[model samples]
Target: MVNLVVTLRKKSQGIWRSSFVRSVAVVASGTAGAQAVTIAFAPLITRLYGPEAYGVQGAFISIMSVAAPIGALAYPISVVLPRRDEEALGLLRLSAYISFFIAALIAVGLWLGGEAVISLLEIESISTLIYLLPVAVLFAAWKQMAERWLIRKKAFGVIARSALANSGFLNSARALAGFVYPSGAVLIVLATVAEVLHALLMLIGIRKRTTIDLSESSEVSTSNVIELAHRHRDFPLYRAPQNTINAASKSLPVLMLATFFGPSTAGFYMLSQMVMGMPSTLVGKAVSDVFYPRITEAAHNGENLSRHILRATGSLAAIGIVPFAIVIFFGPWMFSLVFGEEWSMAGEYARWLALFFFFNFINKPSNAAVPVLGIQRGLLFYEILSTGGKVVGFLLGFYWLNSDIWAVAIFSVVGVIAYSGVMLWVYLCAVRWDRDKKAV
Candidate 1:
């Protein structure tokens, strides 16, 4: 027994000593801190703002979520792929330009038919706040661009600090503002401000720490940006559409619940999603952010990626299963205790959502591997199928079952199956890539 204990300790120590583990720890620590702030303030925030406010905010956020990824035409995600800093800088510039254009176009549309859009979506509660959507989308796009650039430079420390700062400022502001006003518009505006602040912090960090020469004339030139855009055109053509569809699918429940049931129901669903997604934000996202560059480097060196994929998947599964199981069993009780009795329904929604999140939790490695494997086109098709499934499931529950819980339950099941299939496909693709590399 003594020998077994000693051996296990040593093995764990060895694993912790690896660079990948260290990187993940750095990012996760920051994310953990950020999530801690959000969690600490959540009970107070919920009580002050109420479900209807969150539902309004959730509806606005759903629109931003769907539009943000495509704002830069998915080019920001390609930042880590290039071998040269200059090329990466060019991609960054290209993403910024595209994001600005898209935001401007959205603003124009809103100016022309903003009221019509509100009536169409049945979201008149946010008629005044809806104009901020383009601004929020632009901020989100820029934040992602900065984050990807930091990732490419392996500036994980900066990334972590920025997350902490963003969360601290955003939550503190929300809590203070809610104490005075507690309006949905307040939440939406603060969220957008948080994005811009986070982006600026990262940009400043890059200027201070990273060795990349931003002043280099060739890197930020229009021609270089154009060249890089053409070279990575697959992002705009395939990856953009894939991301948009995936975001739409994920946000559909909130929108549908709001339109069919009421904003309060959507609010309950939103709160449940927010609470349940904490684990993914704290660990899964950290792992994905760190793992992306590592796997990209491995692919560039023609190294085998199968082992990395399997190991990451297994580790995430082990880390995520216990908390998710706890939620599955005691979700309602926990939510009632922590968030207030008003949010008990949110807990009910969380129990079913836990099943889907567990799969999503373990699928981060596979999500990171898609771009590395150059399988965006195939993934696009899969997303379409996944989205279609979600729509069918949601509509069935809404029209036939006539229960909000039923709609959420069906949506969760479809998500679980879709993410499971994605994990399998990505793992097989990694295996084939390894085999082909060996043959060469």
Candidate 2:
């Protein structure tokens, strides 16, 4: 009992004092501020655009979300892999080159069969936005590359600043356009503009804050970049597919709902995702981005990762529990009041999705551990199962069950279970790393 009490106390003390927690708080603060700005404009955006218009926007987002990961081929994740900035620079260039190549492929595909694809989603309203899909994917890739480089430097403040600017610019533009009478494609374009701005801001932030001797980077030849890409071939080979599965899984509700129900159903789904995603990204991504570097150092130096993981997991659970509890109970009421009655169904979606989001909240900080632990294949396999489970859940609800709410509930349950599995895998990886070190 005494040992248990002491351990608990130590963890409590450590949580308050850890550099990792401080960095998370800094980034979360900025992200919260950014999200607050975006949320503030939601009432206006929703009122002006309506659910059907948002449904069209949601369809555009779903397509771009899937393609974005493919465009970068998961190379941005390699920014932190190389110890030397020169090598990291090579990785960044490699990511850019791959992004352009992928974008060109998307452009060709769109030119050939864009309208037919949009017709399938029942979002023919935004068929014109299909051409912008490649542009959106390219911007997504660039934003990720810049953001990963900032993470390598532990520049949470810079990231925070850019995040705020990006949100402000994005929502402000959205509101301004909506006031002038906007179409779904216009709204999608405005969102894409925001991504482009964020990437540019990240570039400027890095330039002003972190100095890189491009002279060394310049010495790195095209061959060196190719070698760097090959060195991390697992990223494109394994991680890219994993990311695509992840993206597709997240967008499934929107895509599937639109196919069977209508644009309005997808709009409600999109709103729920928008609301939940704001808070989730604020903390989940902030925690994950900050957690990565510290864990990498611990794994490489043979330092024990158990305590760090324990503190993070406990703290994150506590952080997530209260808000999600409220969401599960009063999500519909909150959505109707905040976004108007048209979005009440969005709140219903949120109630079930809360369980899934909570699990994911706890999972995000540990996700980077997969690559560090050399268990990309394990994660990949689990991702396939998870995605498959989600699809089954959707199909069960859509066909046999014949209810959209049932489908969402089932999908959320599958996600909660799958993400729990992910958390367990990460813990085992840490334990295995420790065991190996002891044997050495």
Candidate 3:
């Protein structure tokens, strides 16, 4: 502990000393800190809002989650690709512009065809609140774009702070607001507030870090932005659909559960996903955000990245084993104790999800290879397969097995297999990239 403190102090003094470690620490610390707050408030949140209300909130989130990724046209993802900040800035503007149009389209569609949408999705509970999807998409997509710009700048510290601020404000708003309105609609409003706040914080961070980033001094124009868009066109063409499907697949358990079993089941599933997914989403995300830029740098300079990939996978796998084991073993008792008797079912779901999350954690950082190595078309195929896997897993469980537990269990099993395939594919791609770079 004493040595660790000294090391951290040195890190704080010289953040550039070890870029990868520093970046990971900043992002991981921020994510873990924010998630800790969410966990700390879970009891109060669960008690105040209850499972059914959470289910309602979860369904709406599921809808926006799918839309937000596509709304940005996935351009922000390639922001790290451009060597010049000018090109990056152009991509940023392009992504933001697309996001605005997507949000507007969603709002207009809802205004004109809200009833049709409700009937089509068989979701009447959130019909009144469906209009808020546009707001959610707009704010969330813009936040993603802003965050991507920071990532391009290697501003992990800024990104980390933003994560803490964003999650804290968002979750707090949801928790505190539950006491007042205590409806699912209130959660949506609070979420919109949090997303807008997070985006503003990121914008402020960008401005404070470098006036040049905020400046038109870069001379990015409509044609320049269009050129960059055409250059990374595959991102929007291939990656957007892939990401949307992946997100929609992730959202399905909630929607399917709510539609088939009821809101309480979906709520239980959402809580289960939240609790089990924390380590992967929090820490793996930190590693991935850092790794994406680092790998880009490596590929740019013809450097080998296999060692780095192996080290990351090993470290995440090691860190994940213990916590996930505990979740799988004692999930039910802990959920009952922490979240109340109503959430005990969520623990069962958590146990079933443990293997899937473990694989997912190992896979998250490696996912950068698709973008970095330009193997997105293949990745798109994988996404389709995995999305089908998830949907089919749930459907099989629901219809064939006639058991919710079986449904989730099959989904988790399929997820583990799908993630393992993706991890292997990325490893192969990284290896091939290294070999080809060396041969040159």
Candidate 4:
């Protein structure tokens, strides 16, 4: 009895000091667990699939990427901004309905239009993986929604478990597919199934807690749903473009590389992103999941969300910078050693892209605070400008001018600096407005 009380006290104390930290830990642990499983199976995957297989997988993921911005329909932000539990619940249900309908449409479209998409992307040469696109998109959308729900509830533990299970199973399945199928397309399909199953498990895990029993509670009214969607219209209207531009800008480089060069060259660029960007993507997401809701609440209360934002940024930078730096410095050797000589060029790409990863770690979460202040429109405009800059840079580097790898590297740096500047400027403007309003 004494020991149990002591244990509970420690847990409570930790939560009191930093609820966000606890939340991040739950998601991080799950992510780490998932990555651990993948890393353990990495050698097998590398040996079996090769860089060309990875290239095909990247194409599949890239095509399916639309599932996020479209299926979400800006509903994820609704989870953070609403003031009342009822309002939030209404938003949740409405968003889920919209998301499900969109998911179905997207799945069907991807299934039917896989050929056209492949041909458009000039990936018809490797059309064997075309059929896997829709199935993967469906599961990806499902997992994305489920993860958002968990993030909304601060159900960090559930998130961690689901992510771990999903990552482990998906990677392990990929390994098995590699051994048995050898066709990169088949391996990609199996990987998608594993991911879908993982996401479903997470949905099941959270449904018990998140579901409102109509029998025990007030009935959900049609008016409530309409009002919920209407109230949160800012999300799809303003926030969605910001997210879309950001994703588009990030995605443009690889697509350009693939178009200008080929899958083999694109694979080299992607391998770098996969390794160096992992920490930024995972850590930034975990921190954003915790900070966005809390900071939004703080903003609503006229509290200084700036300090919290800085603290979150600082924490991520501190932890992520070292790993990022190591990769930047040693990426070439690491790629060669880990993935074999064929992938040695992957290191150069990693070294080049690591700069983006570093800035992205700072840029991503800091950018989230903008939406909390309800400036998603302004954010969208800024992302559009920045994205345009990135597109120009990619074209100059990858196509219209220089196709040399070193020129691509130099242009990428210029693009990162330009985009990073825009991100920081926006963050400053948002913070200033937030502070002024809080003072008023």
For residues 1-440, what per-residue lDDT tens digits would candidate 1 score against the true structure?
Answer: 99999999999999999999999999999999999999999999999999999998998899889998899999999999989787888888888889999999999989999998688667786698898889889988988998999999899999999999999999999999998999888998898888789889998998998887868735467876788899899999999999999999989999999889988999999999998898899999999999999999999899889899999999999999999999999999999999999999999999999998899889899999999999999999999999999999999999999999999999999999999999999999999999999999
For this target, which candidate reaches the highest lDDT against the unseen true structure? 1
Ranked by lDDT from best down, the candidates are: 1, 2, 3, 4
Cα error, residue 191 of model 3, in Å, equals 1.6
**Is candidate 2 or 4 superior in TM-score?**
2
Q: For candidate 1, list the clashing residue pairs, or say none.
A: none
The alpha-carbon RMSD values of the candidates against the true structure, listed in the order shown, are: 1.2, 2.6, 3.2, 4.8
Q: In model 3, what is the error at residue 134, expressed in angstroms?
A: 1.0
User: Can you tell me which runs of candidate 4 are displaced by over 4 Å?
Assistant: 1-17, 104-114, 125-132, 208-218, 404-411
How high is the CA lDDT of each candidate model?
0.92, 0.87, 0.85, 0.70
Predicted structure with the largest TM-score when compared to the true one: 1
Score every model by TM-score.
Answer: 0.98, 0.95, 0.94, 0.88
lDDT of 1: 0.92
**Candidate 3: residue pairs that collide:** none
In candidate 1, position 280 carries an lDDT of 91
